[model samples]
Target: MREIVDFDNLKMYINGEWVTAQSEKTYSVINPSTGKVVANVPNGGRNETKQAIDAADQAFKSWSKLTAVERAKYLMRLYALMHQYKDQLAEIMSLEMGKPFTEAKGEVDFAASYFEWFAEEGRRIYGETIPSNSPNKRLMVIRQPVGVVAAITPWNFPLAMMTRKVGAALAAGCTAIVKPASQSPISAIAFGRLVELAGIPNGVISVITGSSGPISDEIFENPIVKKVTFTGSTEVGKLLVTKSAHQLKKLSLELGGHAPFIVFEDADLEAAATGAIASKYRNTGQTCVCANRIYVHQSVIEEFSEILVKKVKELKVGNSIDPTVQVGPLVNREGLLKVEEQVKDALDKGARILCGGKRVGGELTEGLFYEPTVLGDVTPTMLITYQETFGPVAPIIPFESEEEVIQQANGTEYGLASYFYTQNISRAVRVAEALEFGIMGINDSIPTVAQAPFGGIKESGQGREGGHQGLDDYLEYKFISLGI
Candidate 1:
């Protein structure tokens, strides 16, 4: 008999049972690296989503009643269990999401840290007694769990995004129904399995995956789902907000980004060049905060262009499972075409392609692989400048002054993350503050940790995830007064 992956029988997990959808439709999960059919997830629709919400509602009644210490114990157990399966989860994630094994492992580790952090945070949820103005009157303010939550996570950083929401939900003693992205449902389903093994009661955490339209509508319409946390594109985020507003549902959104990576003349050239590769090309440039636009100071523009373009060419693009591969294919056919359209439009609009601007073919063509492309002489009016190039293509532009670069960088409406490279502390601090992004990094390209909140500004997003900020989304506060 051939061996079968338990999750391959991918189905909805509701009230602790791994079951098929009532709709009986199925969606294929494609391995972006090779464009191979990896697995099939249930085509969950409104009926199945309602089932998940019902499970969560039932779970919340008891879950919310648990004492803080009791809830903390469950999170601690979940954390320890995640550590045990960390490597396995990483491998599954890499296969499903087409991220390199190394990066996928890091994501798994990062996801686990959220569980650990929130597990501790559960014990520290604070309440206060307040002095009342009226005589013999007492006032108290307490933070309570926001009831059943609907947590919808995106494909990128599949595990971490799920953990970011679920961790805070669990920590706050709220039951949740998770809708992991269709492209990467395996990890989320596996997480449900692990939660079961960790001794979590049935219905406390339900995992469901399906088409975006019906499933998402079901979640928003359900009265039992008190809170909804979402991570994805800005357009979708707005639609969700509109739907949730009807019932006054709680929301937390971490949406799209067109992050700017600024390279000043005072920056250490070598470090900036090195960091550019990691910032722009890691995971083949699918990151929400990956340096979409690189603004280089004119003084070092030529030198930076030469070094950066050379490094971009040297990166190996292939299967994510291969340890040698530094870049992988775009996530799907839609993603590949989207990036290709942007690249072609930019090229047609007088942008000079300095290196690699075409798609891979022959044996490589079987996959969604595109070369790491670099463009120069790009004007701000071009589509590539205004829209997000979430693929491996990056456009480099030169600026003459700090004020001009900052103005250009902040020109875009999206403001999730930005990067600066300068050795001078005063200039770095000044530039970092001036950039109109929620998150800024100086001399670094690494994404923020669990201790720091992550989100965007303006069109980028509203609300936050990770750190104590994540806990903020899962709670609601009320004040009460007593007179004797």
Candidate 2:
């Protein structure tokens, strides 16, 4: 079969030019499906990160000066280019991140939607004119770009995460320096190429791939960076908060989530089952918002478990290159090990495995593939109950009352996303309001969209990523009072 992407030509994008690391060093990006090298990306460090930051800083002077409508045109062109090369971008994401090609294609469209949404949203950035308290006085509030922004993205959904941040930043007239996760930098590099083709000015956007520590260090220390947006683990998010404290930089963190999927007896069993499968196993459950704990009404636990297991069993697991495959390998061995450890802990704590419980063997043994798992008799004490199991394992816990389940769901420190299925409109409203999570789905499995606000409360991090609120973090609101 012909290769979809030219892996050899990939390089770091800085100042509108493709370049290699100053150290002449590179790192191999491994394909999780086969444990083989996919491509060697530039191993940038502090020096390259600084260069990218400087470029963005310089670009900000012009980029931020442009009218919001003028910036929207560049984003519109890039959005068109993304659709034009969607197949190649999807292929690269699948090879590097080990997500199914179909899903990757969906992600490409999803990523591009941000550019499309923000392109129009930018034009509507409106300032307020407040009534003056005294005669001959005028009061007004206007929003302006926050200047150079540093976006640190994650491996899972690499393209979508970067676009969610960069799109809003650029739309708000901020230049961005992105440090994509080393494991999946190719997608960002490819997007940078599209940015150049869109006729965006030099230094408006830069994609640097390399060591996370040094890159992040440079971002935190640089005074040129006025805002920092990140999507990753809670531990890393906390560290960024600490680092940014010294400089008081604007920050938007979309951190770890331990979402709860509650299934009430009143819910449609078939619909609940399908939603559970989609929520718990999408991207092999590596997503930050993937349902971690499932709380089923005790009366319907058995029926729900059977239906969920049947649907999970129907999912085909294989290499991402396979068009028919629904489930793909974990991003790396560490992710696989965490899944194994969580399963073992649940089993040891007396949870029963209904369908899948162990790693897949045979031809798939070389890859980081785990069977889509379902565990019954799960309790709060079990490791899988509270921890964010970043894998395709569904642990079912039974609850007797709405009050009891609500308490259990809100027990975790992370409150990023939650879902509950109910036929009763009153119960849906009650549960939705009670859930402490930032984002909630009353009956829907996939609730995220380019037009909605996406973020979390509590330890799941702060600030919004989508909607008009998405542009808020990238902008600074100024109030002017003048006496005539």
Candidate 3:
């Protein structure tokens, strides 16, 4: 990838001011692919977070008073600025998080798309008048901003997740404070430049980095914050859900995912193979919605496995900067170890590894790069069959019948995304309906987009993230009755 942006010491953006932590301490952020220090991000504490929350709280009064159209105009400008700096944003994301250059650029587009989409959606935030039983009475419902919002984003898709939450919140006329994951904070910090260039008020959008735990505690306890939006693990989400109950603050949690990908006997062999590969290997399978459990009809398991292994072998595993690299390193050491554990546990339990099951370390460099692995004879008993192994490992589980496959697929705590390949129209519709997941892809590998509502159910997570309902989490309804 061609380099374009300068990586600088990004301090915390709080209360319309660029400031460091009260203690003047910082933490080192590492590039996963190169194993090099990227920058020293501010180690913000309660003091810094208090400043951000206070700014957002104060700004909300004027910011929410603006017409949706006015707020949307600011978002439109933001969208344009995001495009203007797309190359730089992509480079920063790739350097910070190790996504392939091409993929990072695509992520830039996906993130910017939310601003453009929510800009239009903001203008259409409509009010409705209900028919009154009495002639002198008038009843109506109006939508309003949910007040100050705190968006906690994950490291997997730093820029996109930040925009997904912050864009919608801003469009809903809510001021926001974004806390990016410690693993990758540069993308979130650099995004402040675009918001500033767009002329959005400083407190209307703030990006804070540092000790997220203390920052979150202050936000949760403060009465100024009205909503908490998070995209991370279910464990942490449950903790937030429990703590947010103190003030009963609204919450939007897009948590963990253990998605299932199914391939029936009637599926196009080539399509099924490539679709599974696309869903499983993207971001080296670090995505929450990526296919973790794959089910293949017993009749076609051999051919499906054969074609999948062939394609998995063809993927070029290298640094994210390499344009030709299809698979990149894991985000950190924990991710690398998690993948290693899943593969080891599966192999120990009698699962067969067809290709690429070990870590790859080049002599010239040391990084967290694991081979794109494929496992066969995966049983429901194996840990890899149900665990959310967020790695580029495709474990094909054979099923005897449709009923059995659906039973196996839905037999998990997560219900984020599910996929199945079938030429049978009726069967496709039937299985799609039966699968217990928020997003379903029939004959499709990837189904998420800016225009759709993306989220999960059960233990996967709660609430929606995109499309018309994406703004729903940021707005509240008020009913009015007038007597004349």
Candidate 4:
């Protein structure tokens, strides 16, 4: 059965009202599964973005003044709504982003976890009382909301990325303007409805979809937008850093990652191979923390490559809406082209393709579907090794020693996430620290959780998301003293 999404009557939410876009333009969202246009998302420009920010700014004065318990109630309500609509949101994500339905559901569920986590954090937001050295004097520190926030998210994991930012901001009592990726705006718009159903105040949360460049610039220029939170490529993240710096606006970014999965000798080979299948193939390898480069010790390279090749070959590449499919198409034509170019470059640079490396014949030729590819004999100098692939391609390279592999993994300009497979506890600890990344996995690929802080290091971008600390990004501290 083909799924249909209605976007014709879509409108931007400003001050709790769904209003028509100032610009009479729309973009067609194509289903990568069948190469069919599923929805017509409104192409909002700078004007709509401004309206959202202004509304949020006006709402923040009252919102930030509310008691933490009151704010927590709203988040709790939102969380309940998300749970009620998880299936629909997951289906929408699969249709829009080309992720396997099961994985999409997982992301939707994870997204809901944010609301729950931050909602609890709301009641627990604490201020410190510092003891003074002088007699008859008291000192204390307090934390307060940073005011209106501009949250820009990517298309890969629409729901999770949006909630990761907005959930914390709302829990901290900040109003927000969400500018979701233009490519996949359906789920985000659906999220807007959930906010309303949850009894959130007008302008406390607004959704703006379309061209983000001009809108982003406007929001950055607006003095009322006290913070900017984004999740995307490092190149764009750098620009936001500079723009935020101009006004010294508070910023949190979860940018690009080329996570390396290292397999050392004396490790559980079977477990490592299975882990790779899950980590590298999730969301068709579109995740920021997906394992792109596999660094195998020379002694185990041949065995690991053989097992990995067999697994890659077994991946069912087809429509994301199909429950049985394991891998889906890329997000769009541009992504397909980028992956094609990277694969071709690797082959040209003496790398060998072991399994699937080309597009498959399906109902959608124009749709972006790249085959799950496995490349061997990749050199450290190739772009695939140092740069993020961000597709359904996994390249494996051989390393002789732990020291050499660690150096190779850390060579990239990006240091978002890295993984290792070894039974030696001491070596795991040693290699974990040696690898200069924000997140690491020992015999695992999934490093993020609602209880643990997630972010990157170096050029992978700045700040953290998820966990109890996620709300800290939205708060500023003040110290006060009293003396007789």
Candidate 5:
């Protein structure tokens, strides 16, 4: 692939300008597929983070005053630019994040859809006239931007996660300072270049690359930052909540998920197996909502396992740059270790390895790669039962009844997403309602879209990310009362 943007020359974006960290410190961005350094990014600290915040605070005074329609135009431009540079962005993400090129291209489209969706949604931020107790008195409610926003995005789905949060915030008329994960800051910098080309005003959007602790500390302590949006582990989400507590900053967290994929006996076995593979192994199972535990009906466990293992064995695992590869390397050694540990734990506890259960050697690439794993006879006593195994491993447990499956599925503290395959309409409705998750897919594996509300309940974290509800967390409501 030819290089469009100069990744080696990238810099942090602040106040609508390309700049480097004041500390002059830098860190290398490693390509997970080859374990090679792609580029060096500025390792910003508190000073750089504070400067970005100040810039955003200054810009908010004017940015928040623009009409929703006017603001939508900028997002429209961004949406267009994202499409114009779609291939390049995907290439950047694939090279830096180690997802297959095909999957990365799909993610580029998914990320652009957010901007397109919000461009129209911004114009619909309507206020309401309320009924008054007295004829002479008028009551009204209006929503406005929630000032400066701090978005802390994750490494997985780097572009999509940034657009999901920043698109809504900017559409709602808020200036933003983004702190992208250090592992994948190049993608954010590339987006920043687009933001500049899109003619978004200086200070309206800033991308700061740095250590998480210093950036987070500055964000929490800075009073100018009115709201904080984050997507990461549940442990980090809790820490952010605690940090922002004293400041009373508005928070929208999309945290860790231990999603359950259930297969009913009456469902189509082939379709169920296909859906399970799609949901469990996408992006090498690095996604937060990837199905961690699978529950299959006792009657169909044997048949389902056969189909699932066959499909999994056929998955192509190699470097992400290959167009035909489906399963790519883990982002780092840490992730690979986690996957190995989980698989070992399940095997030690009597779970049978249905298909694969080992690390891949460097015949493909000398990077962190683990085989797409499937474990049968998984019980609750295994570590994979409760922990968020963020890897390419599927642990299948047999369930005798619908009630038994639901109980076991909802047993986890994390409830971001859940899926089930059922042809019976009544059973579908009953189970969908009973599942303790913010997002559910009935006979569908991938349910996330730009037009629908995406969030979680229980320990998965709070607030919504997409749809009309996405703009809510970035806005503040004010009620007006007038008497003649």
Candidate 6:
């Protein structure tokens, strides 16, 4: 066994074992930056998924019985190891997921923080005694882990999202089987190496990569998996919802998001533009929290757009491994195609391409890289504004009144995040309160933190993923009564 992970050939982790699929099935992990094969991974189908699920189930009996303090030690160890290999982990993510090297490194740090945060949180999982209504009666409520968890994370932010679910679930004394997105499964496998180094028990953590259909079926049907945590598209989340209903599994779905970035007339133009750029282009705008719609007041739209386009033009798009590059390729060909379609639709609906609307060419021709695009003359009917663009394209729409902007922002069914910049304290407070979203950024660009509650509302998905509330979804409460 090589101590250094080899993405050229990868294996699924099951019951503390790194092995290939029993059926010898495999899928190639492509480097989105090069359109080249990075590695071939086990296409762990139903049989493989079942093996991981069973391993998790068997481990759960003893793993869940461990004291919360004991479990935290393993998580802390994992966190330390994650930090030690942070650079290597970031490189793998950059290659596999098409994130800029700098952003990839940042994601590794974010991932480590989740484990470190949860390590401390594990010991704090407390219960309380209830006030009995009747004399000579005692009542208490206790929290317990919700058994085995199947955490399905997306290609975007693969490492951080997986850790977000696993850290909290494991901290709650629950075992987990991670099914990472096929496009970026190596990051998940690399994390499994850290879990192994942590000296955690066998079967306590598992990773599987394969087609979603067969793999998802086994995970949902497995009676041993009591809870499921998923972060992906809302449509897929809905499918999981229907599938998990047969077993009534505990579900935490952090699904789709169409975040709105609103800049008021009175906002500091520099800060407003900077916030727009950071919020809109991080992860090349694939993040669920990425600003999808840029709503600037009619009074300041021109100035804001000018500043934003200047910054956007300065962004260097290239291979993700280039440290100086600020923008990278989309995750895969489909992502590129989606962005293409959205831009075309917007153009057909009369939206103007202010700076970028086409793909970049040169030595970087092999990758799925799209230029950082800014669209003006964006209308309410344009497809780019209505749908989750999930690209570096920012559509700057104009609004007149605070009430009008709020209505436009809340019009989308997806409400994962909303951002507004205003110097007027009253306007900021009013707009933040009125916007329907799980996360709000009032003048701040990147608002996500390990200590803050992270998630969305309505079709954007359910359940929180961080802060003190992160562990709640992975746990269940039991009430006890005694008559003395």
Error of 1 at 191 (Å): 1.2
Each candidate structure's count of clashing pairs: 0, 0, 0, 0, 0, 0
Model 5: weakest 10-residue lDDT segment is 1-10
**Model 3: residues with Cα > 4 Å off, grouped in runs:** 1-6
Model 6: lDDT to the true structure? 0.90
Worst 10-residue lDDT window for candidate 3 reads 1-10
> Against the unseen true structure, what C-alpha lDDT does each candidate score?
0.86, 0.92, 0.88, 0.87, 0.92, 0.90
Residues 1-484, model 1: lDDT tens digits: 2111375577677888988888687888888877788888888888888887888888888998998788888887877777777777877877888888878878877888888888887888898999789889999999999899988998888888998889889989899989999889988888888878878888999988888888888888788888899999988888988999999999888888888888988888888988889989988899899998999988898999999999888998878887778888888888889999988888888888889998987767778888999999887878878888779998998899989989999998898999989888899878877888999889998868887889889888888888787788889998989888
Q: For model 3, state the Cα shift of residue 300 in Å.
A: 0.8
TM-score, one value per model: 0.96, 0.98, 0.98, 0.97, 0.98, 0.98
lDDT, candidate 6, 1-484, per-residue tens: 3444876668888999999988898988888899988888988899988888888989999999998889988989988888788788888988988899998889888998999999999889999999999999999999999999999999999999998999999999999999999889888898888888888999999999889989899888888889999999999999999998999998989989998899988999999898888888998999989999999999999988999999999999999999998999999888899999999998998899899899989988999989999999999998888888889999999999988999999998998999988899988778888889999999898999998899999899999999999999999999999899
lDDT of 2 by residue, 345-444 (tens): 9999899999988888888888899999999999899988988888999999999999999999999999999999999999998999999999998889
Summarize candidate 4's per-residue lDDT along 1-484 as a digit string, tens digits.
1222345676666779776677778787788877788788778878888889889988999999999888888888888877777778888888888988888888888998888888888877899999899989999999999999999999998999999899999989999999899878888888888888888999999998788878898888888899999999999999888898889999988999999999999889888888898899899988899998998999988998898888889888888988888999898888888888888899999999998788876565666788899999999777788768878899999989988988888888888998999999999989988999999989987878877888999988888898888988899999999887
Question: Candidate 4 or 5, higher lDDT?
Answer: 5
The weakest ten consecutive residues by lDDT in model 4 span 1-10
Q: How good is model 4 by TM-score?
A: 0.97
- Candidate 6 Cα errors over 4 Å, as ranges: 1-3
TM-score of 5: 0.98
Q: What is the lDDT of residue 221 in candidate 5?
A: 96
